[model samples]
Target: MSVSKKKFNLVVLDMAGTTVADGGLVEQAFSAAAWQMGADPESMIGYVRATMGESKISVFRHLFGGDEGLAQTANAAFEAAYGERVAAGLIVPIPGAREAIERLRGEGRSVVLSTGFARVTQDAILAALGWEGLADFTLCPADAGGRGRPYPDMVLAAFLRSGAADGVQEIAVVGDTSYDMLSGARAGAGVVAGVLTGAHDKAQLVEHGASHVLGSVAELDGLLGELERSS
Candidate 1:
């Protein structure tokens, strides 16, 4: 299926869940970090879930604000824990993830893998999936200059890097969280697609500003088709 409409030339996708199969690893990492930092169970869980697609440090700031030392400590611990978990080769590309990306690229659409992870972790994920060079651009918060998801830094970075600055009207942002949808909307991306293969449900995604809700990244072609026809 064609994953584009009249002018969609870029598809910015999230790392975990959208491109990579998460399998609850992100939640587990957050829980471990929260516990290690002596954060309150209820509040930590709430904040982590609430900010599912933002940077890990961003989530830490939300959960353990006012205490930079503690938040930083917890952040390091979370990265370490997540790194270990992922290094064990537990992570894989979501089913159809490779196909979706390949198909999109084959059609000459620029594909960027944008994530909440640090650069190191993002590289690790790409390596684990044997997709080290698959994406035309692989980016994270650090690469964005400032801020992360729920903000447009990452998506805008994609726009600039992919040479879509003037063609922002042809950009699409696809991820599994409200943060991704909100970010895309903020970036003025013509297509903001939320997939249900990760942390969010359809209702949650729609509530957050997703113009298209997909079953998973595998259905990206369908999403592009629907949005195009609706246009």
Candidate 2:
């Protein structure tokens, strides 16, 4: 379906897998956290891999069988491990990610970088990548009332905070996971695009409600252009 360019004035993007490449750090950190809490990492890895775009605490809450205390401790450890890796310079932007954000903004869109990680870990990544102010704003679960992907809170938060879009239908959401697609769809975004650069595959993305699928976020601006022409 073709959409008007004016329909997507606010762009919400996922951080880790969509814009930033962390080299499987999330799984590694999950393993470390599991081990620290006396759980077998192998036993929980499948679920971890399946829910890539979910908030870490939420993931832990499920893994720990709704034990909030255990979930909190595990989440803290995961953040710490991930933070250390970021401090060691272990993350990099997906090629053209920075350029994509610039191009989107250049076209008068308000770009928001959203993440499933806690604020501290997200901040570490921004600092490491020198992306402190690359987007109009950044969001984590806490910024959106402690809910994340698969619930739509973060995406809705970005829409409300940016005020760049007149309504949910004016928002564009791009990410690399099924959960990201779900969040965007649930939030009633005009365009929920999935990229192949991270976690889930094309089928998974489509199954989760992606309006479009692209090779990478670098193609986002081009996709918008295509949408304009088709419209």
Candidate 3:
């Protein structure tokens, strides 16, 4: 891995299942929408659970390949259902996540959030978390004009937006899913860390190329500090 002269410059976070508590609502919504759109229930829900960190449209497209209109309809239903769920319930922040983020910011690290949810659902979630403007930037796949997790686009977008032009290795990406780990690794981030707070466990994360596996994002600050000192 390339080492940066500056320990680290940016941290790209995954919103759901990392900074925010997911509690499986997104999977529920996605599964429901897919079933309504004529997908087989058994395979559909499983696929969704596996790719929950991915963009809704991407999952739909993969499931309903060549049926762009059907995929679009399913995506709309997912967003609508997910929006309603958020509006009706009290969404909570993951334990210690807000504090950890604040600590990182105190140390002059640029932090941003990338999510699979579209802008509308992300907006409702931010409002619920009271996390508006909490990060330097919060991005959806659409915001960066790229496919979501497991792809490098969103992480690269965060790197650019956070002013990290020279040292890609000075960037860290943290999330609870293997997709997030893959995204960070594919983007050539120095620290592709995975947390167990959302989806995958330690083995799954490691298999996906996570260099550091924490119990949760709560450990991120300390982990980075250790990396900085070790470097």
Which candidate leads in lDDT?
Answer: 2
Candidate 3 per-residue lDDT over residues 1-231, each given as its tens digit: 332345777899998889888687887788778678877757777777788688888988888875899989999999998888898874678999999999988887888988999899999999977888888888999877857888999999888776843678888999998899899999999999999899889998999989999988899999999988987
Measured with C-alpha atoms, the lDDT of residue 51 in candidate 2 is 97
Compute the lDDT for candidate 1.
Answer: 0.84
Error of 2 at 149 (Å): 0.9
**Which regions in candidate 1 have their CA more than 4 angstroms from the true location?**
1-6, 40-42, 225-231
Instruction: Give the top-scoring candidate (TM-score).
Output: 2
lDDT of 1 at 171: 89
Candidate 2 Cα misplacement greater than 4 A, ranges: 1-5
From the highest lDDT down, the ranking of the candidates is 2, 3, 1
Give a tens-digit lDDT track for model 1, residues 38-62.
Answer: 7656667877887888988877776
* Residue 158, model 2, lDDT: 90
Rank list by TM-score: 2, 3, 1
Measured against the true structure, the TM-scores of the candidates, in listed sequence, are: 0.92, 0.97, 0.94
Candidate 3: where is the Cα deviation over 4 Å? 1-6
Comparison by TM-score, 1 against 2, better one: 2
